[model samples]
Target: MEYRSEISEELEAWERKITRKSSMVSRSAKRIQNRINGVIPERLHSIVTNSIKTMVQGVLVGSTYTVHPPKKNRSLQVRDQQAKELIRKYKRIAATEGAGTGAGGILLGLADFPLLLSIKMKLLFDLASTYGYDAKKIEERVFILTIFQLAFSSDDTRRKSYRKISSWDESLSQIEVRKKYEEHDWKTFQLEYRDYIDLPKLLQMVPGVGAIVGAYVNYHFLDWLGENAINAYRTRMIKEENQTT
Candidate 1:
């Protein structure tokens, strides 16, 4: 019980961090990306965004059969510890892939976009299983995307995504969340995600800097993503546990 209290306190702190205003660095980066985006043609933007939107939707559909052994009885600490190990393994894999692709220049740097997205999606599915949630449901799969957006979108979008996450498992959220999921914006999901990563990933195409940028960005991004997933799942578990007791 004491441990749970500590976890809850930690979560409150993390929540504050996520909801805070964007830093100067983040704002600067967003501005730079906006300028870069402006010079780029609208057609090009549409193509890339549509491509990613389709790819992600495909991944969601493909993982529809994902089933876990249903460790619903598992303790949160045990589940989270096991999840951390998996996250470490995934982080290494992403870093290595990023380095290899980044070394290969523009072509491979472009390849990393789709490849990394797939890896990120797979990790989300693994995490849902780890947290004893089934990703097989359409609603849950959409929630996985919400987790992704929470980690990588603009400040406004992140706050919105966090609300959906915070609302998880609460009586008021179920029907509302279902309606929201039906109205989920795949285009915004792709655009915000792309804009967020474009700076480091674009640097990853440079001859001298590509490999290092790729390795560092992919490694840390996955780590950030892992923490976000853990906390999101923890919110639900903590709330449910409280109600039961």
Candidate 2:
């Protein structure tokens, strides 16, 4: 009971943190991203959008990926511990992949886009399981992906995504998340994702420093995604407890 209270307080604090206004640094970074977007060609953008569209479906929905079965009926604290451990495990793998590809220069650096994305989705599946949610369900998969968007997006985008999942217990039943996933806005999703990481990923392709940049960038990316997933799931679990009590 005491642990639950502590976690509830933590969740409330996290909620406030995310809802806060965008910092000047974030605003300036978005402006820089806008300029970068302008410089990139539409043809390249189309290619990227199309490619990631297929990749997202395969990774998030396909049966190819499997999460090891987690014991059921665990307490929230136990689940939270498992989630953190999974994140640490995957973070190392992502960092290694990033370094290997980054050292290969432009071609390999390009490969890291899908590679890093797959690693994230994989982590989400494991996380869902730890939290006693089944990722095999289409709606659960969509929710998992939204957590990714929440982590990587701009301040405004993050807020919008956060609100959609804030009351997921009621909202999931109220809306057709499955259909929403089917008709997802890949172009916008990919655009926001690319813009967010454009500079560091761009620098990651530079011959001499590519490896170091890739390692650093990918490590932090997975870390960000993992943290958001934990908080999102924690919020949902807490909501369920409150309703039942």
Candidate 3:
């Protein structure tokens, strides 16, 4: 009971973080980012759209990351500890991959985008499984993408995404989630992610700076995602427990 209470406190703090309002600086930055995106050519946008679509599609259908079965019932604290370990391992993998590609110049720097995305999706699935969630479900898969959006979106978008994630289980039945999976706004998903990450990742294409930038960005991005995923799942778990009790 004490352990559960401690976790409940941690979840409360995380809830505060995800629900906080956007600041002026962040709003201004998002405005500038939108302006910049507006100036980019449509041809390039189409190309990027196709690329992201393909990458995400491959992961969705691929069996590479689905080997692990969902873990059985465990205490929230035990699940949290195991999730931390998974994050640590994936962080190292992302950093190493980033360094290698970043050192290889423009081509390899571009390659890291999809590679890192794949790694992130895989880790999210693994963490879901660890938390006893069925990763194979369409709703669960879409939830993974929602968590990704929460990590990479601007403040306004973050708030919207957080609401969806917070009430996800209540918003839709399993049948509804599965039936409406194809209705997800994937274009918006890809664009927001690209826009949010473009600056740092673009810098990773430079010859001398690419290597360092790549390693640092990948490491921190994975860390951010890991934290978000943990909190998202924790919130859901706590809510479910409350209902049952």
Candidate 4:
């Protein structure tokens, strides 16, 4: 009986240690997420916002200028330039002390950033493709968007998001919500605008950097998108607001 009792006590102690270790890991992850958010600036948020706008414009142009290669060419160049600028701005932000210095540090600084960008790009690419844009051009846009996403984002989370966004099969038979703009039956398209499109739009309404991160994630990441990314962005924005205020 005494031996059994001692064994029980040892098991309980081991469990307690495991629980403590788990708690520490959770806390550390949260702290790391918070730190990453703190490093990204409002300007990076603005870049996200601007990228969404550019994407929207691209969609509109792609829908209306289907046959005109010259016009499409100009529009594509403009969008590309804007995307490049946004990437540049993001790089500047990532280089700061808040964003961390070394590769590992930078990875830590951009935990959720890639996810947000991936979501945004997925939405934009789908929208453009649905509007009768050339498949090659759509693919090009996807590639460019992915590059921009990677330029500003680091970490395993971001990389995974990129892979998810890149791999999304928009060809699946799903419902479509934007009937007026769509060429095919709503039922033919496997995804509804609300699922892949409007959700991103709603996220864009969030104020300041929070909306930016939310919108980016909504448009780019798809299934890989997580609330944790938005939460991390919000926490960082709050910290910045507090510091400035």
Best by TM-score: 2
lDDT of 3: 0.81
Per-candidate TM equals: 0.89, 0.92, 0.89, 0.23
Worst 10 residues of 3 by lDDT: 58-67
- For residues 48-137, write the lDDT of model 2, one tens digit per residue: 787668766775556656866645889989998988999999999998998999899988888888788788888988998899987777
Instruction: Indicate the residue-level lDDT of 26 in model 3.
Output: 67
Flag the better candidate by lDDT, 1 or 3: 1
Off by over 4 Å in 2: 67-70, 172-175
Go through the candidates in order and give the C-alpha RMSD of each one to the true structure: 2.5, 2.0, 2.3, 20.6
In model 3, the clashing pairs are none
Error of 2 at 50 (Å): 2.5
Candidate 3 lDDT over 1-245, as tens digits, reads 78767777777787778778767886787788789888988866776676667655554554545636789878888999999999999999999998889899978876787788888988999999999988776677778877987998766788887898888766677677545545656667677888878888888888998888889989999999999999899878877888899
For each candidate, the alpha-carbon lDDT, in order, equals 0.82, 0.82, 0.81, 0.36
**Which window of ten consecutive residues has the lowest lDDT sum in model 4?**
186-195
Error of 1 at 85 (Å): 0.3
Per-residue lDDT over 211-234 for candidate 4, one digit per residue giving the tens place of the 0 to 100 score? 344434433433222122222222
Judged by whole-model lDDT over C-alpha atoms, candidate 4 comes out at 0.36
Clash tally, candidates in order: 0, 0, 0, 12
